[model samples]
Target chain A: MHKTALFLAAALLACAAHAAAPKPAKPARSAADVLKDSPTSDWRALDPDNTLLMDLAAGQVIIELAPRFAPAHAANIRALAHGGYWDGLAIVRVQDNFVTQWGDPDGDDAAKARPLPAGASPKLPAEFSVPIERIGKSAGFTKLPDVDGWAPRAGFAQGFPVAADPRTGQAWLAHCYGMVGAGRSDAVDSSNGTELYVVIGHAPRGLDLNITVVGRVLKGMELLSALPRGTGAMGFYDKPEQRVGIQHVRLLADVPVAERPALQVLKTDSTTWQQLLDARRFRGGWYVHSPAHVDICSAGVPTRPAP
Target chain B: MHKTALFLAAALLACAAHAAAPKPAKPARSAADVLKDSPTSDWRALDPDNTLLMDLAAGQVIIELAPRFAPAHAANIRALAHGGYWDGLAIVRVQDNFVTQWGDPDGDDAAKARPLPAGASPKLPAEFSVPIERIGKSAGFTKLPDVDGWAPRAGFAQGFPVAADPRTGQAWLAHCYGMVGAGRSDAVDSSNGTELYVVIGHAPRGLDLNITVVGRVLKGMELLSALPRGTGAMGFYDKPEQRVGIQHVRLLADVPVAERPALQVLKTDSTTWQQLLDARRFRGGWYVHSPAHVDICSAGVPTRPAP
Candidate 1:
């Protein structure tokens, strides 16, 4: 009986010892890992109709339009693309830590400015925002779990970074890095999609709800961001020769099928996205302290080549 | 008596009419206007001993060191400058939407590595944060009005963006655009200030409290940020020819007095700075919606050539 008791105590001790031993920590899943493990259903292919393919001397810059937020501007942009309005135009302004603007260099000179295309409107009503109800909770709006200083609520809707105010019942595209907007005069309704600018520096959130944000760059932002900054006021190039010439600008639908970019954007509402957020929030390995927070602009939308 | 009474009634009516008339609205002051009106006392000249002047083929890039934050690292950097350690070295990495790193290309290869200067320490402890008491309210700590996700509290201290945790009693320099940091390996204390990088894109706040930030770029950021992004992994240039060569690096004090850069930085504690903040917060004219909040990084430390 004593021997049996000793054996039982020894077994219990062994169990306790095993339990006390520290197990090796599992490797933290990175955003890349989450993307690799994501199902095919979690990624959506770009609709050619809603895409713009702009070619510069450096490289191609692909942009995805956000018609739900700025329908009129998007439509006008499509018409302008079809009209090849920006084919030979130039990136006239590149303000360091601000934006890169591309349009007709003589846009301010009415006599020298190019005429608007038949389908493109000469003037557009400010499409700064739509009704909040249009992007209801039922929609694929993955809200960020953090406070934004500029917006009431911030999130991603249909692959675009957006801000919404339930109290005002308004939703608008945010001015995150790579966000494209229409440049306008002092008048609210002056912009007509002729002058477009891309945010290449920090997200100019103050511009949110103030300008007509039409789309965001899906790929090749480096081509635009790395351009030499203009020395003129507001970063306008002093000499016409300094402006970066555009090779071509076309709607992706107009491109040959074989030349179309095979790209996929991760769905923000997927489970893998949630894992990505957690991974960003609690960064492991080499990181001594993780703030348990991610800025709306910093939590970039992930993209990959289509399989 | 009737004529007198009629005159009195007329006077009263005139007074009432004057009171009812609306006052003309005052024109909003712009940031440029504020600077124009600023007193010389509101601007400070750069301290020659605390400045680094590096010449590339493009132009001169100036850096202002933060010795209070990382004294040992700063001392090591001063030694390096005296030894001309970075002379003829190359800018080897430029990650798009990230940093521009520079150092000896063969730093990792023991046989080909450049030797550290006589006074520069080969190994140093991580100087990520100092005691919060070091940067107390008594110091020139100007707290920002908006909330930041990365730090418990964020503000400017002596023209440098800084984050502090009162509870943890720690304060560290923030990783804002243009901010410079010492690049280390996986180990926290691995850096001896030989390799350095500058933030060239959006503020990577995730790096806060993780790496030792040493200084900030005072001028010529466009030269660094506009470099072609390296095509290799982590943005390292795959070929030696792709690396941008550094012509010379020297302490401003070491240079001839006439050759020193004459520059001034706006004092954050001045009344002009408050006006500048208000001007930025309440954008007028072209703006339709003014977001009252400004991110710490977006509220750039204004610098200009000395008049």
Candidate 2:
């Protein structure tokens, strides 16, 4: 087990299986190597209030909500989750190279849709974006070097990849792989935080501001992403049995201390994080030619075992 | 069965399910709708000479080798395919949001590795990229409006998403979702066309000139992308039973007429293709905001049920 952990650690740092590459006489240290030596202060644990745990037959999924950006949606989700609104729900959609959506499978059929528990908001004003000036004080906005096609500037805000339009003073979470958002109708304010989806493929950045993003899956994204693609409409499951059942949904705050997951995400604003990006943007190991630029979506936000 | 198809058509065209919002009286036609109206001439049939077919238990994966860019690798692959080089091999790795790699399970161990077929080339020099000027006249270089961080211009060249660095006068296939590349060791020229991996998530554009991208998966990407992620190092299956078995692989030319998949891909230079992009970029119907920009990866090359 110890040996396997060491291999996994090195593999994760490399980000690719370049283990077959012959080591140079004095191999230049890689980004993974730089991260391995990071200071303890470079990582931060999940805030229990913001962390939501989703249990499936395969495994537990970890999500860190962005209440600072979508307070109403986040709050509504918390209430619904605490009241066990989604305990027996099933994942209804898995579009290949797109998104995986889950909630009440009958969410479209109002007559059959499950009742919303009291205190859970049934509707939410489009919390598509938050003014950067408003959340700038509390949020950590670590800017990337390149300009984003979707917005004037792109970066990570409190661990979530984000795009910002400084002229409008607005910044919102980018729809990168693993991003979770409320599924909405044509109306901008239709999302009520019940039907939700997570991007499972290429970062559909154009969806920014068009959808109400809530959080991102920090772990077990594979449980959702790797599901069979539905042949039905919008990748919806045609048969009830095809849907994956949700065993339970619990906020970290509600879990007993002994049972909570031990997790910590690298601090995007830390010096270690900057070094990691530098190493990736200017890769040194095995690669013959290194690209000077890195896309915001391709730059993975590192997560590690908690302290 | 017919009802399900209609529902899927409407759902894909509508773009999303609006559970509560009033349906638009005259819903704006979407990218799907626009493509549905495209003239038959807009699409070209997949060339049997360039097409390669992979069979698995679940489905058949179709790939179109780009001889225009990586001819030597393409030629070697053709020779390997005709020799039944990949029969009974196993898909050994599935890294979530990364790639699905396949080939001989014992590839890394020379003692156990499968022998290179009688006529197959071994230790081919890296064919990472091609000069645009060399292939410029023969290939279609339909440039997108925006600049890619990795390259001065990005767009499609001969039906594949590509990036071009005008400064270097070189253009290479972008490592977008569904792209296939030769897996190699630390040595740049070590690849012998035996191991392969496909991009299953965000476009890893940084890898443009770092590795030899031989082709792109034209169909059945879901068969590979949606597989269970392996738990071992680099997402290799910890146990042999977990590996997905390959039935056979053959170039379309080697297959009889009855066995060939009838496929057509939209031509990049067609007016219909432009209209599709325009519809996606300046979405007319339900969306409140239509991004003026579209990332090269999001513009999926449309495929149709062949005539």
DockQ of every predicted complex: 0.26, 0.36
**Model 1 alpha-carbon miss at residue A101, Å:** 0.9
Q: Write the per-residue lDDT of candidate 2 for residues A1-307, one digit (tens) a residue.
A: 0010111111122211121222323333466676788898889988888889999999999998999889999999998888888999999889898999989987788899988888998888999888887446367777775546666677787788888776678888889999999998777898998888999999987688888899999988999999999988878889999999998888788889989889999988887777666565555556666565556788878888875
All candidates: TM-score: 0.90, 0.90
lDDT by residue for model 1 over B3-59, one digit each (tens)?
000000111111121122122144445677778878999999998878999899999
Instruction: Please give, for residues A1-307, the per-residue lDDT of candidate 1 as tens digits.
Output: 0000000011111112112212224445565677777899999998888999999988899999988888999999999999999999999999998999999988889999988877999988999999987676656887775556566677788888888877678999998889999998777788999999999887888788888999999999999998999999888899989999998999998999999999999888887776676666556667776655666788778889999
Window of ten residues with lowest summed lDDT in model 1 chain B: B1-10
lDDT of each: 0.80, 0.78
lDDT of 2 at B144: 77
In the range B227-251, model 2's lDDT, one tens digit per residue, is: 9999998788999999999999998
User: Which residue segments of model 1 deviate by more than 4 Å?
Assistant: A1-27, B1-28
Which clashing pairs does model 2 show?
A: A21-B186
Runs of candidate 2 with Cα error greater than 4 angstroms are: A1-29, A135-137, B1-29
